[model samples]
Target: MTTVADLAELVRAPAALSVPGDVVAGATAARALGPRTAALAGASVLLYWAGMAANDWADRRLDAVERPERPIPSGRVAPATAVGLAAGLTAAGLGLAAAAGGRRATAVALPLAAAIWGYDLTAKNTAAGPAVMAACRGLDVLLGATGGRVARAVPAALTVAAHTWTVTALSRREVTGADAALPLRTLAGTVLVAVAATASRQRDVTAALPVALAGWYVARYGGAQARVVAEPTAGRVRAAVGAGITGLPALQGALTARAGAGLLGLAVAAAAPLGRRLARKVSPT
Candidate 1:
């Protein structure tokens, strides 16, 4: 029963900690320049949901191929309805971004929408998919940073973005058992870990270790997926889980200064079990 309704749950997928993380990261960065970041943080969540809905709508076809049971293709949700929903989400997100940072912040909203559309329509098929995916995460973070300290935060966002890119690729053919999914996921994780090791000068090891462990498990498990995706919905939700793993380090990093960070770590550490429960509850089939 993890029908198209289940796939539609993705409307809230990107809105979770990923959006919160971006808002916090952006506001923290922008605050360096002396701005009230609370308002910015609030708007970011709206934008995140909007962006995700647009992405889901754009990728309806690809999802249909990889996930025939999804809303748009499964007859549970109309394609036209999904498109209209995406448009509404986009408009709302743009308005929120505009209100949050005026023209500078609002400016990125359109690009973000374009990027989401582009990725759905074609990026996943091109070699540039990885780069574009990575860059997209970085750009979203930048949108948040516009409120406080833009320059200082860009590097960290870029760091996180690189990891995100790898996860995106991993969730693709590699994690979906696309014949070459294993090697691709391995290489992507390896490159990301290697980059982190070199850039953070071993400090990232503590965080990198868990990700490495996850990658190893991914390598071992091949492309087994979440049970919630109707028929074989694994591919659609596979990449969705990447957020929890890649975010582990930054959460750890945040722990050094804030108790909230430690709590985040706890949340991420429990993501697998939680996701399992969610998958089962949503997909009950």
Candidate 2:
């Protein structure tokens, strides 16, 4: 029989912890935070969870061969049930977006959901995989900026997308390990992302929190990439991927702080270490 633990693993419940801050950073950057921010955050988490479920469902056959301990392959959850959950969550996420921010939010949510499904079903093994996954994350950030201030949120969205691309690229090698050069390149990209994130905001007393948080984000994520660069082993790659996923909240928090939501940004950043702690109990990847 399937227990709640099985479902939690299926959806990567701990990883979902990294998702809400995407919306918070976007909404704060767009000056769009309102009653809808909470709703959009919830919608983002639902969509993220949906993507995780869909990913397992689409990879069920492959998992049978390589990851037999997974929910579907292990017989702890039916394939059909996993797909059904993905579909249901997608619909619910779209509905929440629509209800919270009307047509604008729905517009972004539709494409976001489509990207999630596309990545799972057709793009997972393609060269386009990392880009597609990054787009999904970028759209999730934009979902919170649909309140007529989307243009203002572009920088935050792009920062999040760039960070996601590096993470996804590393994730591709989690099973087989990567060439040292690949992680070295990603490490360079991480530095550029950190520079861009910090430079985008004005330097002042108000910039202090964002700068510090962005530095923290860089240190944590960059440290993981450095490890992979040194070892280039599957275990190191997997650890880097997990760190990337869980460390995202810190990046988001930095962006949120850059947008003048320092306190709120700190609150969001707090989720990262918390997510890491939870990952020890339940795998985030």
Candidate 3:
């Protein structure tokens, strides 16, 4: 029988830590932070968990050969169970979005859910995989802005999408490993993402927090990618992907701070270390 721990692993529960920040950053940019923000964030987390479960279900065959210890292949969780959980979570996520932000949030969430399913079922192995995954994350950010001017959240959404692009690109190599050039290119992208996160029209003390958080994001994720550039082994590549997953909150926090929510951004950034710690046990990738 499947236990809660089996379901948690199937969903990569700890990795959900990186998700709430997307909503927070978008809400900050759109000036929509309020009680509803929490509900939207919760909705985002459910969608994220749905995606993870769907990914495992879709990859069950590949995982049997390459990663048999996974919940489905290992017999800890049945394939039907995984797929059922994914479907239920997806429905719950959409319902929650409708409740939290009415039709507006549901509009963004519908596409986000479709994109998540598409990436796992169809796009994950194609050349457009990274872009598809990135689009899902971008839409997630927009979901949080439904209560305010969504146009104001576009830049932050794009910034987070760029970061997701790099992470998705690296994730493709986590199992097969990659040539040094791939890590090199992703490292370059990470640097550009950090710069974009730190960009501001007014250079003042307000800029300091975002800059620091971005630096932290780059250091943690970039350092792992650098190691992959050195070896490009499957183990090293997996490590880099894991780093990208856990380090994402820092980038999200930086985007939130750049949008002028310093203290809340710091709270979001705090998730990075906690995610890293939990990753040791749960394996976020």
Candidate 4:
């Protein structure tokens, strides 16, 4: 159970997804489009931590309803402390981005901060929430690209955003508990659409495998969920997917950034074998 007493822990949601590996992979691939790959990855991961904290703070009350165990409502964290931490992290993330890309990175950071804060405070309950989430995803990509000095982040940013909507939707299935089937199907559809969009870039059968494998993962575990209790099954499914997302990005960065599509396939194949231990991008919970 996510609790309020543990607000410090809330920041890790976005952070985990950010560094989990696949994002690093995507960022690595995009790094060639810029100048400082490592800096961009660092800033991007920080941005993710800040974004999650900001969102959680904004939605703390709502979360208490669905996830009373989350640090805030559970009394594990002080609201003021959480707010300060979020602000500090947000500033740090932007500062890093600015250092790497100068004014251009700062420009990108403003909208990202606004979008992340806005999503948490108000937009999440509306139809616009999902778009806001996608925007953050796109911004993360942009931040990573800016670090690498790439001005042409539009295509990859859009590609990542489209898939982000799926993740957001999949996440929606889990509130007080996790939902199994619909989210999986939605994830499959989203991945396919993203892969279809990928055709605009990769233009090879190899590009298709990631989506196909993702779809297979969904289908394989989605139905089996009926056999187990909702909480545990959903948690397991989320864990696998989460671990895959976390690690594959790093592997993808290595392969795709280096122009090795073969390596991207290897990342997908290796996703399940890796550990899902989530590390903090900021204050560890």
Candidate 5:
């Protein structure tokens, strides 16, 4: 019988801490932050967990060779159970979106779900893997903007997507050690993402919080990637991936602050250290 721990590991429960900020950032940008925002963030978490479960299901065979200790490979969770959980979570996520934001949220969520499954089943090993994964996160941000001006959320979505692109690109090297070029390129991308997050036309005191959060994000995630550049081993690469996962809340908070939600952004940024602490136990990657 599969234990709760098995299920948690299968879905990467700790990593879901990075997901709600996507919704919060989007809603703040679109001026849609309200009661429904929490529900939509919940929906994003469900979809993210669904994607993680589906990823394990799809990679069960490969994982047997490369990751024998994984839930599916170790026989802690059956393949059927993982796929079923994935489908159920996907359905639940869409239903929650429909309930929270009606047709508008569902409309965006449908594509987001498709993108998630598409990335797991078909796109993960291809050259387009990072882009497809990034699209899922971008769409997730849009899902939270259904109640307001979605167009206003585009820059935030793109910023989140760009950061996700770097993470996903580096994730591909988790099992197989990469050359120095890979981490070097991703480190450069991380710097660009931080700059984009900090850039503001107003350039007043309002930008201070976002700038500080962006700096925090770069220091944590970029610092890990920098280590990988020095020694591109599988262990260092995995550590970098974990850092990217846990460091995402700072990026999200930066985007939220840039959208004029300073206190809420700070609240969102608080998840970073908590996520890092939890990751030590559960392994975010």
Candidate 6:
């Protein structure tokens, strides 16, 4: 029997916690917050977990050499089992989306699922890897906008996709050290994202919370990238990747706030620190 610990490792469970906020931010930005939002969030988590499992399954051979401690390579979980889990979770995610929001949500979910598989099986090692993964996240945000205001959610989708691009680009170097320029460039990108997020809101009572959350996101995530620039070791790169993954909720929260959902944004922002704390116990990257 595969233990829950093994399953958790196989699915990168801690990182899934970062996913729901993506849908929340997107839906809020689109002004589509409805009873369906909860179901869409659940679908997002399922799809994320499915992607993680598929990634491990596809990388099992390479991981056996370079990451023998991983669940599949270490024999804690079988490759077949991981594939099955990925397929099952993908199906569940689509079903949940269909059940919650009908055909429109299912349409988005279909492409999102295809992107997850494509990234894991085909595009993961290519130059297009980061871009494809970013698309998956962007589509995830769009999935929440199935309520028909997808055009209004484009900015939020782009914002989340940009953040994901930086993280995915850096994740490729988690094992091998990266060029100092890589993290430096990503740090610069992070700054621009912060500026954009904060600038969206005028100085007002509502603006304060979003601005503060965006500041916190940049401070923590950008600090890690800066450290990687100073020392482009594999360890520092890993740390930076971890921070990017866990700190994303704050960025999402800022966007949610800009969408005029300040209380919901604050709730979303609170997940960042909690995700960071959980990461100490289970690596997000």
- Candidate with top lDDT is 5
Candidate 2 TM-score to native: 0.98
Off by over 4 Å in 5: none
Candidate 2 Cα outliers beyond 4 Å, as residue runs: none
- Deviation in angstroms for 27 in model 5? 0.4
In the range 194-272, model 4's lDDT, one tens digit per residue, is 3433343456666655555444444433333333234435555454335334433433332343333455445534543
Q: What is the C-alpha RMSD of each candidate to the true structure, in Å?
A: 6.5, 0.9, 0.7, 5.7, 0.7, 1.0
lDDT per residue, candidate 5, 158-250, as tens digits? Answer: 999999999999999999989999999989999999888877776789989999999999999999999999999999999999999999999
Could you tell me the C-alpha RMSD of candidate 4 in Å?
A: 5.7
Per-residue alpha-carbon lDDT of candidate 6 for residues 1-285, written as tens digits (9 for 90 to 100): 789999998898988878998899889978899899999999999999999999999999999998899999999999899999999999999999999989999989999999999999999999999999999999998998888689888888888899999999999999999999999989988998887777663667877877888999999999999999999999999999999999999998998988899999989888998998888877787
* Cα TM-score per model: 0.66, 0.98, 0.99, 0.70, 0.99, 0.98
Candidate 1, residues 95-209, lDDT tens digits: the string is: 7667767887777656766776677567867888877766666676677667555785666566557656655655564335433444445445644543442243334435554
Better of 2 and 4 by lDDT: 2
Task: Quote the positional error of residue 240 for candidate 3 in Å.
Answer: 0.6
Shift of residue 231 alpha carbon in model 1, Å: 21
Report lDDT (CA) for all predictions.
0.51, 0.90, 0.95, 0.56, 0.95, 0.91
Instruction: Tell me which of candidates 4 and 5 scores higher on TM-score.
Output: 5
lDDT of 2: 0.90
Q: Where does the lowest 10-residue lDDT sum fall in candidate 5?
A: 195-204
Worst 10 residues of 1 by lDDT: 252-261
* CA deviation > 4 Å runs, candidate 4: 1-8, 13-35, 147-152, 176-185, 197-275, 279-285
